[model samples]
Target: VPKGVILTHHNFISNVRTCVAMFDITSRDTVLSFLPLSHVLERMVMFAYLYAGTTIAFAESIEAVAQNLIEIKPNIMVSVPRVFEKIYARVMDNILNSSSLKRRIFFWAYRVGKKYAARQLQGEKIPASLKLKRQIAHKLVFSKIIERTGGRVRFFISGGAPLAKDIAEFFYAIGLIIYEGYGLTETAPVLAVNRPGALKFGSVGRPIPEVEIKFAPDGEILARGPNVMKGYYKKEAETREAFEGGWFHTGDIGYLDEDGFLVITDRKKDIIVTSGGKNVAPQAIENLLKTSSYISTVVVLGDRRKFLSALVVPNFEKLETLAREKGWHYTERKELINKPETVDLIKSEIDRACTGLASYERVKRIALLDHDFEIEKGEITPTLKVRRTAIENRYRELIDSLYREESSVSSDDFPSEESK
Candidate 1:
């Protein structure tokens, strides 16, 4: 699809109509579309572009997004949270790896900008002291960074995953309004989006016009609006299960704030309750762990138990690089993990990540695995989601050994312990 064209199934034309009417896009607008046409988000956006007579430039592939963005110099770009995270990480890495004075100045400017942005978002009138500092930071640091966003992007929208509050604020402070929205493939994928001048941090903004959002008794988000899909394709039973009464029952667990903003807590199915009667959301802990470059995968465990623990799979490549820099000899993954010094280093890193978590949700002990869990190993889904049940079963022995203080040696050294 190229400028002024739409690519989508006819069944979803209604959603396209809604988007076109809502965004008020025009022929002058250019959209660099690349998300799969089959997906509701891409389809809806593409159709909306056509309805507005807007120009659409399709990227060759996901890898070509940067080059395409530069070529297209799009006015709007919509992407999943993962894409934004990668860009943020790469930018931060570059800043950190710069010269000492540049790194310090970059961080100093970031802090000043963040404070100003936070105050503005909270509706606290900016003080003169902060206002002046923010102006300097914007000109000297933030503006240059924003220019790298193809120099023409006016709005950046994030969906699919929870956008970290810090990342959102950082971008906003730097003059980019990264609007976080909430929806699913079932709901034409755009129930609520933050509009210009009406944005809110932390919460997904108010429901879009014509969209009705409400909460279920169990905190599941429900929607009743024109954007709602007709039903599942050729699956009446499944479709019926999706809607209760008149609202589409979104399986995600979340709540609408007093101001009518949506705040997702976790998935209802992903909540874990410990034996001590403490409820924990593993996703929160997992998200924190992933902030560390060393930690590639983390599964927090304490369900029906006294305390939380974890099974971690380190990013071996990053760890090897660090080990070499620190003058440590690295051999096998297990050997590196079992090293007392390395284990302590990981413990400290995990502790830092879990600093703000509730005591019950904090990981008390960690066991590093030799390899990452993957779908091929029957430990993950094809979509790269963790197969919690399979992982728990496979690591049952190691988990049990971690809880047993009587064991003097590592679980791998004891056949009985390893066999479980």
Candidate 2:
């Protein structure tokens, strides 16, 4: 159940002050506001922007963000990881559909850009020759991609979810900066954030001055600060439970890296302990799989099971194109997903994406769904976070059948597939 937070006027003011100074926002900056104002993250940020006298531009809708960006040409914007993931997927899909010569040119430019970005992140001075190559690459390939964001986005602020490391790097290579942050509504929504001159791709930056972070024995992040909410609104028991040790439990599992940057593993409740006793952080794997142009959404599963499996929702647009190119025949969505060619394609994508993961952490079986998970079905939340339990419950028979087939298959045999 979702409980209301009993926040005070001081809560917003303190967070707003910290945000203004933390980000160095000024009157000259204009921010594009897309997230709903009622969300604590957006509310506190709007307050901060207003306090700094920064201009705010309201997006017409999420679907209209691209047009709004071009019109407003704002200096800053904030969004969840989903937005970046879609952009990455769309761009990759287009590249895959382009001519062979264009594909080669894009890849060459991408490599040069990636190398240049890596050096900059390491604080190594760019050589003049490499700098010249980077400029050419920008003009040849990245400039077009950059134009989609209006060519003037100073930086983007990502919150509400963890931004995938690959997506962050890709944006950097294309001359865009995504500063991912971590927070919750109860904390007035600002904890740690990546800022200019103090950048890291994969990790959320150090905790803000107002908030204090610590970890529970199980690695749950706990926070104590003036910005923390007083308690749940009229839910005293829940409030007491949340602050059992005088620290508000964040329920997120993460740790501070060597550089003091926070690296979120997964949600404490979502950690899967297999029958073999190996603990798996599903979100990281799920995020990795989502980077594939073929996968629209996925949920990794194997709680107390022999091996990991997944429920995949294919990017039908890409899938159909692949089918057409390969001469695969299908009359409808269901028939399309079950075709041997389609199954093999998705399986290959899963394997390609998880090549670096340990054996147990990798998905060993998959069941493909023709349609994406829907909020109306309770398979995903409004923000697109998968509702694992709800999904598993709804697909229990299908999921169980996967492991059942797994048990019968020889151990030496590789992964299996199912279609739903």
Candidate 3:
């Protein structure tokens, strides 16, 4: 069996191949490796380094990545979206916690820079004044944050979750090349990635140098290339179902842009078909909801129903701050969410956020969950992805109660409405 000596085995082969193809690491290159050896991403990079005769410096733990990064200052980095998100969040949080004048200046610069970057991504010709302002922002604000990311990070690749476009553009504006990629465990992983020089803000770049991609009539993405897996380990039927006419059938629904970049819409199975037969992609709606700092998670539900509804989990910290500012009495999470006033506040926020969405995709009703959904509770995956089926199963009763016309009770007060 093809094997690697470092990191976890999650998507090992693809990760290894990615390193070989992209970085072109040689005997002289040094890589600071810390991701779990059991994960395919890390394992592949480790093996690739070995094959290239490059020096490998393994960090003691994730806690030590920063210290190790400063010491090693490697030429390339591969990490999950969470790591980057935390870095962006920390920088933004620090600015927010700074003096009011400094915070205002930072935000003003950030907003202007972000708008400029968005225009650039759209291929609009930037005005000279806006371009000069962006340069000033890069020097005064964004560059400092990039320096904190070890300063030597030539390229940062994000996968395992959607890297918010704003975050991607923020890094780009700061002169850091943060490329987004798309893959799966079964594909031996690396199918498409945003190339270093040629990148897009919203799109996840084009298919990698060797991969081939096509779309099914139903819009599901189908892949074919050397990187694709042979088949499922022991599930022959599943393997057969996964490959259609020589193309590995990816359950994800997406389209290839005019320039051949892949833009994933949502999962085919995750599509919510309303009673009027309108197909709504919930991930789009969920992504829109998350843009609101107050919302942590949102699950849209409306399959075979008249309209879309959602269960939202608030960012408790932000919610609490809002509560304090508004002079609300509730302190506990449950008490806060169950309050009529809080419910109305969240409803207003939801309506505001979903205002631009299609009528069918708009969240018509919402129920707030008392606690954040966690993996330990089997509501989420180890990767922190929501297990949609598990969530629907766990909250069947609560969801039913929300839809009941006669029900006036809170989410916690509702009876379990599980169907037989």
The models' CA-based lDDT, in order, is: 0.74, 0.87, 0.73
Estimate the lDDT of model 1. Answer: 0.74
- Candidate ordering by lDDT (highest first): 2, 1, 3
Residue 169 C-alpha lDDT in model 3: 80
By TM-score rank, best first, the candidates go 2, 3, 1
**lDDT score for residue 372 of model 1:** 76
lDDT of 2 by residue, 275-345 (tens): 99999999899999999999988889999998888888888888888888888887988888777777778
Considering only N, C-alpha and C atoms within 3 Å, which residue pairs clash in candidate 1? 3-56, 275-304, 275-305
Q: For residues 131-199, could you state the per-residue lDDT of candidate 3 as single tens digits?
A: 888888878887777667667777877766677776788777666778888877666567788875568
Supply candidate 1's per-residue lDDT for 56: 84
Best by lDDT: 2
What does each candidate score in C-alpha RMSD? 5.6, 2.3, 5.2
TM-score of 2: 0.94
Tens-digit lDDT track of model 1 for 1-420? 111112235435656665566556678888788777755566667767777888788989877987788888888877776566556666775786689998988889988988888787778999999989888887888878777767777788777667777678778877787888887777777777776666888777888777888888888888887667777666677777878787988888887788878888877776788877987878767877876666767788777877777888776766777788888875676678876667767777787888877777888767787687876888864324577778889988888866676335332232212132
